[model samples]
Target: MANDTKIFHESWYRIANEKLCLRSSVKVHRQLFRGARWYVLSDPFNNQFYRLRPEAYEFVIRLGLDRTVEEVWMEMISAAPESAPGQEEVINLLVQLYQSNLLHYEMPPDSAKLFDRYKNKKQRIMKSNLLNIMFFRIPLFDPDSFLKNILPLIRLIMNPLGAILWLTVVGSAIKIVIDRFAEVSVQTQGIINPSNLFLLYIAMLLVKTFHEFGHAFAVRRFGGEVHIIGVMFLLFSPVPYMDATAAWAFRNKWQRILVGAAGMITEIFVAALAVFVWANTSGGLLHSLAYNMMFVASLSTVVFNINPLLRYDGYYMLSDWLDIPNLHTKATQQLTHLVEKYAFGYKRSTSQAYSLKEAFWLAIFGVLSGIYKLIVFASIIFFIADRFLLAGIIMALICCITWIIVPLVKLIKYLSSSPKLERIRLRAITVVSILLLFVVGFFYYFPFPNSFRASGVLKASEYFVVNSKVSGYVKKIEIEPGSQVSAGQPLIILENKEIDLQINEAMASLQESYAMRQLALAERPEDLATVEARIQAIQTRLDRLQHDREELVVKAEISGVWVVGNVADYLGMWIRRGAPIGQIINESAYYFASVIPEVHTSRIFDNEVKRASVKLVGQADTEVPVFRYVKIPMEQTILPSAALGWKAGGDVPIDPNDAQGVHSTEPFYEVRAYLDNNNGMKMFHGRTGKIRFELTSEPLLRQWWRSFRQLVQKRYHY
Candidate 1:
């Protein structure tokens, strides 16, 4: 609840004696936000807006051109003592109104002071522009006349019927996109290529142009004026922007929300149209352009425009929908209020939230948005630095100054000068100092449990891949798959009638040749050489046939479990030379074959790894201990199993051209960790799981710094 009890600031004594009132041109409008009645004070001449609670509004309404601030306060106190604004609140309200140029003093304002105030306002705007350099905007022209000229033609489509038609078209486009998902996915990869960059930029320009116009048209449709149209450097890329501040005065929340959402809706509609054009057209300049338009439209809308974390169209829309005005600013204030009230024990500090629920939401949004901004800015800085080092470094310095240095300086100024801490300055300083030290100590000195995980598949350490040694028919199945087998154990029996007949024929011929050789030796010495040559050839053929007859049975090469796929299907089936039979795996000797990212190799190799374990994907609770590990020196693009790649529903990205999905897009080192099989966990070949390596205990700050450096080195090659 607002503090209605009277609390006067020392400066209020002088201000209370002076008579002040709002300018005649200033208008006051009633509004209800979050179930509480409020007033919006608007200065038409300056186009400025200020929101005030009902109590504050009541106090303001009582002030007149001839009435003194002290008189108004006394009358408000008599009329509603419990709901009246306190003296301090009244003084703050007057200061805000005066600063916004909505107030007129009884005496003529000094020209020099007025000029100084104007200069200060300009300086503030310049400072804000400098801080937000990444999203800076420069107004170039008035677009109201242009919007007025186009309004008549577009008025008919800015209604419910038009909305229905848009939905129908967009729905159909969504279906087409889903149907040709693969084609669209492949096209996305080419959007960033140098050959298509100009086309992509053109597409982006057109889409953003349409988006800005969408907001303008929506505002115009709802009797709002759009005075300024300009270019904004969004992430250092120039794009169209428009001022739609007129929508802020709209009585209906839905109207305000529609104005905010208009840009995204327009972008989506354009993307839907582009989808149709891209789908129907054959490969050409037009087709490529249409596809690029679709890509940019969808990407920019989702990534920047519609995302609520960033201060964009969606953020405004969310604020309006939730009945929260100036959400970002208020949330920030709420956080500051929390630190002041709770941490510093400042009694006068107050939250911008109207209720506890609002305070909770504000805190949540503040933290999330703060973190998101850091991530976004960091990414942009690194991205620019990778392209242009000197420019990027300058930008980084500016960002650090604006985001870090400026905020810290302001905080120190507040701590040193703010009157709210007059009584507890020493206490606040001591508490804040201790808190800061505690945080630093926790991050720098405390040891934390740290581990890195990688996906892998289980395999037998020693396994023999069985293949057919001779061509024949699979006559009989001597052993089943997964059954225990010994070395030289018969797994399959093969028979070939042709081989048997050939062996018999060779033996008969050999016998005949032997007889002829003997007869030649006894009767004719000259013919003995020819008979001996024939006998040698026949004996050689007989020996080969006898050897083939002995190799009719397929046997296990080593003693272990017999592993064969579709062994029964091979029974009575014709077998070919060098065909795969299966493997005889030593089940007891199982290991996990994992691929570790090149960046993480330092953590595995440089650090002393304390422990390692493997967890099967579906069996989250079961952890298989690893007894030994070996890292392959060679980096390979091929993964150990398809199960560990994207195409097979795994996390790792694979080359799109690799139909088998076993080829990784980036090279990774393969590491084999022997798993202890004594835990009674069923081990299977090709079973996918995650392997975690626990490294030596270290402070989290050091680990985070190392990981960040590794990422920078890997990505920027620094």
Candidate 2:
């Protein structure tokens, strides 16, 4: 019982003399919650249902057109005062039943009051839906008759045999997805691409159509009516929806859970079929459509329908499985109760939780769900804003008004005027004011540690790029990779059969010229000169050929680690002259080449940076200090290493046209910082890492504003 409730209501006198009874059209059903039986009064005409406790149900059943409210109340109190509801409870129950059209009254004035309450209830529902513009819905027609028509087919599929088939298909699809996981993952990158938007939306509509029918058919199969079928504009995108609340009247909790999970089950089955279609097809409209269908089903089921944090199918299933009806509403009430009872020191505040375990769960779920909702909403706003700025702005304004501004106004009104807080009103106001001030101070006034990270690769300050000096096939690798070698050490050996043959031929020609010259000297002095010239020319060609043969042996020019890669794999491979073989890195000196984005360069360049450090991807825990640094003032689109670009698994965006992945889509400033590698770790050349620059402390509010401004300037060019 609430603290606000009394033994009797002052206005009970006006209803005490009135005679009322249960409407003949109202049907009662029984269900169990927390092992206790609860009765549900279903008004078929309005498709509305209300739950009643055993005591309240007894009082309601005893009332009739011939019996007055006072008579039933007096008998109930006299018979069982401990279990019986008080007069105040009775009055409230009567008013609720009357508003639900479950109560029949003989008086015209009472009927008029009930009609006004019903109209007000409708208005409140409309206002509430309007406030939730992101998930707005429009009812089209009744689905009960249509579901009834398909009852036989629904029964055929929603059974044991159907479950087996669903499992087999879904299992096969799961296997296919796992086998081709890489391809599927790559395809997901283009799911939201402008070219696929039309097909994606079409796929979503088709999948959602079946999904809503799944719920309707499940309800109808279990002897329940689905009255409303409509379109819900989820994130301003139209999707099919259905009313399955009639499942709440089922006596079996598992039945209710089944009704809730039916949609997801149907969607997964459809997605499984889509997987087969997508996997088998090559490339066409059908293939794209199948892929899109799979994308829509999996994304929606995982992100929304199956997530218990949102008020979707999974949430209802969780509630039914836990035997906790109105879990979300009760959680909010539990939080409010805690605030009133503990925070404001209210003695009369009642808890919504029935046990300590329930209270703990309620509190945890309340906090998490609230936080998740905010994150989801903010993410959606930003996601839409990236594409449609105007639509995003409108959604953001609606969310701010509904979630923040209106709630704050209501909280202030409650703290000032709530009757339950009459004695502790001043304390409540003070506590709330302090909380608000603290929150504001934390965001706008308090200093926080400020730092930014840029992606780049480590580079050796001194390194020699070993290149092949001769065009020949590799015969042998003289030194292994990472071996210490002398300056004149042979790194690799190459062979040129053509050069060897030429040298042999040149030597033979020179010997022949020498013999001819000897003969010419005895015959004619002029001929002897010509023979001598020929011998010299032949000798010169032989020397050049021998020199070319000597050049076939590739030797290290500098002493350092021999950084040849896959040394054994180079055997018999043809190498062109001047091609880079590997880098001979001098590990004594190393530096980080950090790619600072254009937006962050201005902040770090003009601000006083406290310190800078390097965190290599290979050694994430070790932070190497920067001994010295230099910033290149010019804007450059080319990255120092391809590993720093998105194409190579880095955060930096790469230009789609750059196949080498060394060119960034935007220009960035490269900061070279000599790292102190004295920390007993070797830094390799071209190793990827992040450079962290600790800057001056700033408030979170200011940081957020600056980020927002940068985003606008970058996206809109203003």
Candidate 3:
């Protein structure tokens, strides 16, 4: 067994003055990321070692006294003489033995001191506990590790992980705050136009920044490095983050913890300050903006960063707090053991290295962590429920099966792979696959509905589901579906028992009262005032009964016919009270219209409005004469007739989305004009003509703004 192991061992080392001197067969490779260089060395078949990180070197210094002869298998190589002049690098020190031409005693003492300075000048590296970890646990204090460890970290001076991270967090957070306030400032009390879930959104965004910045600046100040601050899209929403991997040399527990909490600390400060200012201010856009800013920063962090269920800020914090080598590995092992014991119901007859107590604790933590994960994952799924939920379910199912099946198969084949990385890589690949599938499948599966050019005909009519005031059966269908009618046109006749009863009761009372008035007047002409009062009561009763009967007749309030509803459904068909029999449009004056939902706009322009040809309903199919858009005040209607029907001149309504510099209308207003008709026929009362109102000939700046607004609205809603 020893002989077989020796073949893969591939190295032999001897110690001199507690420093390792090695003679090995391991091969090596060197590389760079931008200007930063790194090296890799390994046994021929397995046990790959990657060094060049300052942390690895620090590990060598701190743990060097305990390494066996076999562990001294690698060294970091650099082209430059990293140390100051007259000092030898670690590479030169370790490899000096290979240089055969050497004179030890013959060399001058000064020369010897220069050669020895490489090891002699060794600075005692200190490792501090990360402030971030402490704050994560306590959350009340600032993360001071970033500032304290900056100079101590030999490598971090050049890398800005800590700075980059916190700065990114601050920037992202500020942006979110600004955007939130910009919106909140626009709305006031009693204003119905503000955004929905506006406050929640603000809070969530603020938290995102705090969490991200905690990572970035933590790395920078903790002796790690960072660069970019960005927003990542998980299905639909934006999540901000900063890269902070520079603090590895800051091996102290405190430094790592500080980096973790830096962002959170900043978030706390910003949130607290924001609220303080908000409370002192009066109600306005500014105050609303402040409140939203603070709220977003604080809550988002608590909900997102405090849960150690995933390999994020919270996870790292938990790992440090628990003193675990790897949280994920422990979870995985416990899960496997759980399966073995509960699923297979196996009895352990063999002794294992893990004690029962440790296993018990691991099991408990694992289950709790699993529950946390369930909640977090559920939240993520819900957040992106629109398109990603289906994909998440399928991917999760596949992953569960893979976790069970692949690990067993991998035991022999890729057994050398690190368990810590396997699950992470699996998740990365799954996310990538899901995103890729969305990209390809979205275009293939969800084909857009047919689009028509937008007709200038803007919808300016209020809709009502006309209900019958009286219970009735259709006695007449004077106006058919899509037919125009007068306001007083008889829509239907009801078999109204209640209305008839009311009329009869009212008529009998009216007759009695009138008879009493006649008797009173004849009895005493001097009491004429009393007789007049009786007469007035009779007249009121008669008038009320007549009005009730007229209401049962069901006349059209406005002129247009059932353009959208069917009266035929009510024809000879019984209707109950408040049953919507049909709808009607004004005949002499009508507003051309279409509806545009927030989701899709291109469809409106391409399919309905731009390539539109207007014609009165029942007109011939020839192209209508196009007319330029005329800006007119809303609420004005251009009726086709005057004394016979409605007037020819009326005001028009403007589109709500379009802004008019002049506050012409109170509340909300629209700009519309007399709808023109051109389908080779004249426009008539109750006829709908597709109007092509040129809102703007969007080009240059206008075109760009439109595109920009649309992009923001569709993806960001800001």
Best by lDDT: 2
- The superposed Cα distance between candidate 3 and the true structure at residue 197, in angstroms, equals 9.5
**Native-to-model Cα distance after best TM-score fit, residue 668 in candidate 1, in Å:** 3.7
Clash pairs for candidate 2: none
What lDDT would candidate 3 get against the real structure?
0.47
Weakest 10 consecutive residues of candidate 3 by summed lDDT: 1-10
**RMSD in angstroms, all models?**
3.7, 3.8, 21.1
Candidate 3 per-residue lDDT over residues 1-718, each given as its tens digit: 0001111211121222233322254434443322344333333222223333343333233224345322333322132223211112232323332231111122234434434533422131111112111111112223334434554552443246845754665666566556667544544332222452565455556666666665665565444445445655433346565545444334455565666666666666677566556656887766766667665665556776556765566666766555443566676667665653343343321111135665666667678876776676545543443334566555445445444455445643432353323534454345446765886566555443332222223233443346787666667766566766666777677766666777787778767767776777778677667767766876786687677567667777765655534655666777776877766644343354422222234433343333334444355364453333332333422222121111212122333333332221222212234444432244433343443333323334434455557654554445
lDDT of 1 by residue, 1-718 (tens): 4453346666565667667778888887777776778788887567778888888888888888788889999998899987788877886687778778888876434422323435478689878987989888889888888888889866887888999999999999999999999899977877667799789888999999999999999999988888889999876789999988778778788999999999999999999999999999999999999999899988888777888888999899999888888889989989988988888887678778767898999999999989988887887898777767776878889899998899889867877877678888888878878987998899999999888999898888888889987789998889988899999989988898888999889888888888888888889789889988988888888888777776778898899999887866888888787887888888867889998988788888788889999998777799889889998888899998899999898888999889989999988998899988676988888889999999888899999998988877777678
C-alpha local distance difference test of each model? 0.85, 0.87, 0.47
The list of candidate 2 runs beyond 4 A from truth reads 1-21, 65-71, 86-101, 105-119, 502-548, 656-659
* lDDT pick, better of 2 and 3: 2
Instruction: Evaluate model 2: give its TM-score.
Output: 0.89
